[model samples]
Target: MRWRCVTGGLLVVMGLAVVHAALEHDEPIIGVDLDGNLFINTSSSADGHTRRLLLNGVDVLRELTELRQKCAGNVPRTTTTAPSTVAASTAMPVSYTGTVGCQLESVPSNVTHLFGNVSLSFCPLLTAESLKVFNELVYVSGDLKIELNTNLTNVDGLGSITSVGDSFFINSNDALINVAGVGNITSVGGDVDIRYNEALVNVDGLGSITSVGGYLSIFSNPVLDNVDGLRSITDVGGYLSIRANAALTNVDGLGSITIVRGYLGIYGNDALTNVDGLGNITSVEGTLHICSNSQLDTSTVPESVRSLGTCQVITSENCMTC
Candidate 1:
């Protein structure tokens, strides 16, 4: 067996290895991962482990007896808590990380407490007054990519950006029409990509973005008509692709988005007719891809998004029962 081909060549030159022991003190060291996977650590100061793994002959004692009846219906019923009147010096203050960037008079007049990540496309002699020296940067913590600035037009000179912490990419800027210079940015932990700005029309300075922990793409902006400035978004934890905006008519500023954990693509807008402003989106954990809008009318999709889930309103010949 040649030691099982030298122990599978030391498990392919040493890759997977997760061992944490602690026996005699009450035996419980289950870490078996060899294509079988079976890590168990409910914690006694061992390490984290929620519960998931037992495929291929699953029946681990009848799935631990249905996971102890779903962990006794998720125990924890002994409450008595009341302690949090806010006040941690009124919170806020946690910026400053590192890496600023270059050019625009080679910034760094103490960079106003500069925080991390700000790739202003490495200054290909960026103008618009070199973004008014990043308006004396207020915060960025991470990601604020402004790519391929082909004579970037209106960024309103980075209107003293508020916060970014992660995602805010503006790609292929061919004379950007508006960013209103970070319009008093409210929140954006990640994903807010505005792609191919072919002279963007309206985002009216991002109308003070409300929330977007991830995903909110507006691709190929060809004279974007109206996102109604994202009307104080109500939550978009992920996925909300509005593709190829070619004069998008109205999404009625998303009519106060009512949550979109993921998937909700309205593709190829050619003057979109009605998403009925997403009629207070009830839910869409995934798949609600309304395709190629040619004056959409998938019954004006948004009867709370077809009862909340899987909908592929396809190729618009005016959404003939797609």
Candidate 2:
């Protein structure tokens, strides 16, 4: 198979005749960049003519291998497509695909928009100062996940980001106090999950997010006292779950949510006394689960939502009606 070199160390394979054979081998042809990031050229059966350059570590390679096996015989061949022209100027915003691990020292300072997913997980050295490089990033074309960062106190460094094209996940950060840094983000094209942050007190930073195309889950954050920051979210395309947040007293911030396309679950939040914030929700397409919240006043649940769509309404376990 003939190979064409593209910018950013990507190599596009021309022939699809040997694509399955190359994937079947124990060691597929892969490129390793100076920063130790892995790159692979893989055929996309969906389009059948163009191949995509994927960037990630070993885990992504393994996932690609499994995908190749599943779609082995179905791939169709066509004339090889020419590579897109790359701009030589460094001042231009770099567009990329696939997943990128956030390495503080290696991050490109010129990037304003990243076309793929970004993950900042288990990064012990990632402090507020080091995150300043990302202050200029205005958008992410895919998911942005910040998880398990032990030393990070706030995400104020992400102040310039206006939107995420896919999911936004903030999970398991031991020292994170708030997500005020992402306050400028106006929308998410997919799910928004904020869970398991031990020291998190509020989600005031998310006040600007107006819509989520998928689920919205804020779960298991023990010290989370209020979601008043979520005042702007108007729609959720999937389930909306706020569960196990022991210190959450009210959902006053969710007052703007008008529709949830899937289930609405508010379970196990011990201190959640008021759900008056959910007063504006006009529709929930699935089940309504408000269970195990001992101090919740069942009467506060608006009569407009008592029926909760076509599905069952589960209100149980010491929830008193005022």
Candidate 3:
């Protein structure tokens, strides 16, 4: 033992041999910029309740080596997925392996496209519970093609739920009808295109929010009566159309708005009486047709726009170029 101590002393003095050694790989420590390329060795006891801390460099390396040697092959070294904690009806924490916060480069080759299957029906809508009502369906991967909206989706047939997240996709739903109770949503990251929803009626609830990213069109919502929520929006990057909303009545919230490139078409809103909101509109890039509104009145329109556009009514004598 005295000879062994002498040999250890000589090794320490030489700096070539030590009782412990650093591991092969260095992992990136994640946080808000505090790591200086260093991490101390840390672990909990067998029960995993109490932790033991080891200091810098060689001593840590040695203790870890001893742990590995003592356990032989029991140390877990790798994980195929990101960390995720799920809550279910059981209301207890259940840990499962799944890729969540991984960036584009971190994704595995097995996953080519993220949201693979575009199913029509949202067959089983995910609900919130006591400890974990998901306030966000966020995607931190930094991909523009994908969206992370928890409060973004609105459903209506059965007193429909309009949970607000980011922005939920239409997902190619065809034979769908009626989105009623979905008025609580107040924010949209992108455009809100309420197209191809044939049986949709009275989309009056989406009024709480005040911004949108892209074009805002209310096309083909055949029975939609009023664009009440859209009244506050003052800017649009693309076209702002109320085209083909046959039953739409008022464009009230668009009071302070002005469009640049796209047309302001109110082609077939058969019941629209006043384009009263267009008084402050200073310019238009395309046609501002209030044609075939059958019930429209030119008295509310400014005289400058009277000659630039035509007006129509159900009565032949009060119709066209009014």
Candidate 4:
């Protein structure tokens, strides 16, 4: 009878014949079978048999750990007689509607979702201190447009938002500097447009975003340097455009992206010298445009991207092999 307990990324395996020995009351039995099905035995049946419950494969260990932590202590656990009633009672939705003003007092707290399209533009009074009201915002159900807010320096109050249901635009903000406030956002259901911001330096705050359901345009930010903050993005459902960022030096932050559903455009970036970050990209459904980068070594374009799926390759006016 062999018993193996694995934590973290590895799976825990237990001999099927010795299942009973691993099902002690104090020991929560969790294991994968020969057929690759994950199961957990939390309670024993009246007939002295261990009743196993199948679990979804997603983050199984983390879920199990959380369950154990919640069941700890002197808190009483109640069995639900009607699961539908209990779920309905606990799943009450909280939402906010309409455009949000620059004033912190105009926004409500503890709201899980914002319903209508929200725009914070041309508000001279908007600053980091007045944006604290957005700390409780978890999701935006519509487009979030923040543009031309001269007084807004940082996006500190938007740290709590994890997802956006539609497009996200941040453009032409003269005084904007740090964008690390939006670091928690993991997904954008539509386009993510960040351009024309003069004071913005780096996009490190957008590191958590994994996917973009639509186009991702990052262009014309004159002082913007490295795009290291976009390292976590894996796929773009539409076009991926990075153009005219005069101060950008490398595309190293875009190393993780594997697919671009639309055109992959990298042009007019005066200071760009390295495109090695685009080495991992496996597919570009549209045209692959790489041109007008004076310092870039065109020969450095990875061989893996040379023959991407049904795309026309356009490379010209770079330093070499153009």
Candidate 5:
């Protein structure tokens, strides 16, 4: 059981190699799918080990380095692999709507572009080390989809992914206990949906992202306990929904997240006590639901909660009925 102590507020900096050093092969990096998506795996080892099948073999992940080098190192092939219209020096501008395996050393600041979307169902093996270097490893000009594959029990390398410019879909990243990359991303030109990652426990890195030009959805992350970084949001052109997080207790950090053009729904969360972080929301063109959390106790809620705009707070069980 290795305990990785990251520096204060610096989410997702572990190099792929660094995360590999922290991995314990006896653990399975891939997890069981909590939902029906065969591609969604969200289990992890509570003992604090990182596990994944990076290569054909399990654990040591020796081949990951080789594979990453191969996939990410694809500059324009001199001979031409796609077509006469496609540049002989590059991969055709095509977005793979299916799972594309990747072995990359580092995500480069520059990229190999062929205009199209790339869809990837999370492969069984990827550590924080590899994920941190993702921007320097793979090259994509359009959308990129990474559906959490199964059985993840740790939050090791998750904080490393910093950007998804276009539509980025990450569903069921269960067993994930930390969210570190949210600090580094300045914008998401497309929709950003993070749904059903059941084990998520913290929102440590999201303080840096000031805007989401598209939709912002966070649903079904049961173990999630905080929403501290959601303070700077002033506008979201699309829907903003937060549902089901069974153990979630609060939605602080947003004295300014009061205005939205679309629906704003927060329901089903059992432990939530307050929505004080909700600033001065005056109007919602769509529906707004903040109901059904049975155990919420407003008296016990943290002081971090800012605005109490029209909030129907849930009183604690011991309150005297006047």
Candidate 6:
């Protein structure tokens, strides 16, 4: 009988015509080459009523057998190509209405248009390096909310953004120290709320903002000493609230504001001593409420506001209902 076997490697066996006393041991055996295919062949023969065997291709069989024996104790190995990694410049732009988690170590530089809100709220591992992606962005077609990011120290990366299409809420960031990054933004289409930031000490970064389409509130910042960062604000379509800031000493930054279409309330600021900042405000179409500010100079209250009489401007702690 004769047969051939081909596999990842080659093997051959021959001769069943004569008897052989013993196998030879002097020749070097061949090894299975990983780069080549395996070829195996065998032949057999028989005589009437007698059986005899001879090894003709013993070298080929010996080499293949030796290779098989050598590899028996080791585990098989497989080859495969590696998966590709994402690069910041080639990533596609996307809109997110709900939270979107990103595992990439870099942010895309070409992103434009925020079809929906972009919130990085409560992201514990987010650092300024990851936010560098916003450095080139000039406009956000939706809300730009960055709050509760414990490690965020400053928003300087967002320096190029000129406007936000919706409300701008930056609150409750434990380690936030500055927002100088968004200083160039001239207007906000919705409410502007900046409160509860524990380490926030200044508003100097917000120097260029001139108007807010909705209410503007800055409250509960424990160490904030002044509202000077809001120096350029000229109009607020809704309420203007500056309250509960423990270290606040004055509203000196609001000197440029000329109108408040809604109510104006400045209360609960323990260290506030004056409203001298409101000197340029010519109109408040709605009621004004100024109370609980222990150190303000009642004399400094704007006459344009006190003349309304419909408003309350109480400086005394024991003052009765307005």
Candidate 3 yields a Cα-based lDDT of 0.45
lDDT (CA) for every model shown? 0.73, 0.80, 0.45, 0.80, 0.54, 0.74
Model 6 spans > 4 angstroms off: 1-107, 308-310, 318-322
Summarize candidate 2's per-residue lDDT along 1-322 as a digit string, tens digits.
Answer: 3333333343434334422322323555566889999666454434454433333212334444555555554455578888869757556666545567856555677568877888988888887776788878899999999998888898888999999999999999999999999999999999999999999999999999999999999999999999988899999999999999999998899899999999888889999887888788899998887778888877778777777766644465833332
Q: What is the TM-score of each candidate against the true structure?
A: 0.30, 0.68, 0.44, 0.68, 0.53, 0.66
| RMSD of model 3 against the true structure | 21.6
lDDT of 1 at 84: 83
Q: Candidate order by lDDT, highest to lowest?
A: 2, 4, 6, 1, 5, 3
Q: lDDT tens digits, residues 1-322, model 5?
A: 1112232321222233423323544444444477854341323456655445332233433344444455455534567566577456754332223223444432232333314554546766754444543433233445656567555444333333345557766677655666565355555667767677766676665666667767777778777777776666667667777767887777776556656667666667788777665535655556554556666554544343222223333343322212
RMSD of each: 28.5, 28.6, 21.6, 24.2, 35.5, 18.5
Can you tell me which runs of candidate 4 are displaced by over 4 Å?
Answer: 1-94, 101-105, 318-322
Better of 2 and 5 by lDDT: 2
- Give residue 233's error in model 1 in angstroms: 22
Error of 5 at 20 (Å): 99
Q: For model 1, how many clashes?
A: 0
Global fold similarity of model 5 (TM-score): 0.53
Cα-based lDDT at residue 320, candidate 2: 32
Flag the better candidate by lDDT, 3 or 5. 5
Write out the backbone clash pairs for model 2: none
Write one digit per residue (lDDT tens) for candidate 1, span 32-79.
888999777643443553333233434243455655565566555788
Instruction: Give the lowest summed-lDDT range of ten residues in model 2.
Output: 16-25
